[model samples]
Target: MRQSKRIAIIAHNNKKRDILEWAEFNRLFLAQHELYATGTTGKLLEQELGRPIHKLQSGPLGGDQQIGAKISTQEIDVLIFFWDPLEQQPHDPDVKALLRIAVVWNIPIACNRSSADFLISSNLMHNEYQPHLPDYHDYLERNFQEHAIQVNRELPFPVGTV
Candidate 1:
């Protein structure tokens, strides 16, 4: 089985409602994929959309760290962070790290609703997504074809040569 790209939804206190609305709008696409979120945002989205979600702590309560770990592990493919640019986050380092990792890893990230909408509305989300559980066999399988071609090119005698 292959793993679907993991997506984490998070929001600042003021943007929670917006995140919920976005989640509700894209529930079908989201439901088929794994959802991780900060505490209040997760609860709210779950209640409004009638969907169960894996909840992490509140962002101020180490939730951002959780996201950072997932991003570093390449477990999180998209980060929908609805942040309030005006608010001063006490855990600023966590926020910085989360965004930094998202950039460093080249994974898609959305800091506002506009970007979030663009991401969820992408063809990748609209099409059917095969759920990959626990193992990333599918991701590996998808990459294998390219790797095989590269391997063949690098071999002086061509691949599978005696």
Candidate 2:
């Protein structure tokens, strides 16, 4: 990760005020990084912080998936998502997938105000840190080999003889 981290901020409907307040309190620290947010959250944060934010579609409309894609590609370094646990979201699967992708990519994530505070205040946030990336080559090779064997077994002749 670079010293200037790429941070993605998101908030569910009920938790928007909390995230906005937290963000406003930490505006100076947040301003040092590249910020991204979903539609309404982006607009709100931009107005509060008076800074430009990279805005994506609303969460229900695929913003979570967009952030997940960025995480997979190593374009985002941190995730601060203030999701309401009590309220069930219509796009819950996307939210879960986004969280899973963040973990899979070994990036830092904060789900609430307390966690976000700790994340931003950490010394790692101000410096470059190399996160370990798990190798999936073996996994991919195994799946491909299995598929080839299955294909050969189902065919009238061996796969290469065709």
Candidate 3:
């Protein structure tokens, strides 16, 4: 990741105020990095920070998936998602997938204000850091080979003759 990290911020309905407060407190540091957020959150942040934010759809409207895609493509370096754990979200699967993808891509994630503070304040945040990416090539190859074997066994014709 670059010194100027690409940070994605998200907040549940119940956590919006908290996120806004946390964001306002770190406005100066946040201004130095690239900012992204869901629809409503992005608008609020832009107004609060007086800067541009890359806004996507609302969280329930596919914003989480969009952020997941960015994480997979290495477009986003950090995720500050203040999700409401007690409240059940209608789009829970998407939220889960977003978290899964972040882990898969080995990006830093902050689920609450305390964690966000720790993450943002870390020395690594200001330096060019390379995160460890999980190796999936072997897993992919193994699955493909297994599928081929299964297909061969299911075939009606003899292996050499077919």
Candidate 4:
């Protein structure tokens, strides 16, 4: 099994209550590790869990983007976001980006209550999950060169750098 991990929780306005209720039910299991969430969702979960959470901006205001960056950088290991399917949100694109990133990174994601339940109940999920993140200097440089040449205009990569 893995070690400890950073987890991000997010919810749509309409689904905030559901997330809160779910968190409340599993507070003990959740309290053991790092927690992050969007503004309102974090606030509500903190209030319900009586624990501190690293809160990002509101979803529409870039909270989702903040979480996305964290996940992309492998700063987040688990993503349990309760999205509202019936309602069209202004931040749908952000949600899609986050979901896509999660998939690309092979991080575990729970989009609904049932999957969330399965995750929280799993021994591996609750025990610990540590990601082995190595130096990204070369990786970042290569990616930047391939995808964002402008972003690396100021930096230089050494020969055979890893």
Candidate closer to the true structure by TM-score (higher is better), 1 or 2: 2
Query: Per-residue CA lDDT of candidate 2, range 105-154, in tens?
Result: 88989999999999999999999998898788999899999998998899
Give each model a TM-score.
0.73, 0.94, 0.94, 0.78
Q: Estimate, for each residue in 1-162, the C-alpha lDDT of model 3 and write its tens digit.
A: 899999999999999999999999999899899999998999999999999999999999999999999999999999999999999999999999999999999999999999999999999999999999889999999999999889888989756884
lDDT tens readout by residue for model 1, 2-40? 235578899989898888888888777787788888889
**Residue 63 C-alpha lDDT in model 3:** 96
Worst 10 residues of 1 by lDDT: 127-136
Instruction: Tell me the lDDT of candidate 4.
Output: 0.85
For residues 60-104, could you state the per-residue lDDT of candidate 4 as single tens digits? 999988998998877888999999999999879998998988887
Q: What's the best-to-worst order under TM-score?
A: 2, 3, 4, 1
lDDT by candidate, in order shown: 0.81, 0.95, 0.96, 0.85
Highest TM-score scorer: 2
Better of 2 and 3 by TM-score: 2
Best lDDT among the predictions, by candidate number? 3
> Which has the higher TM-score value, candidate number 2 or candidate number 4?
2
**Number of residue pairs clashing in candidate 1, backbone atoms closer than 3 angstroms, sequence gap of 3 or more or interchain:** 2
Candidate 4 positional error at 71, Å:
0.7
**lDDT, residue 64, model 3:** 95
TM-score of candidate 3 relative to the true fold? 0.94
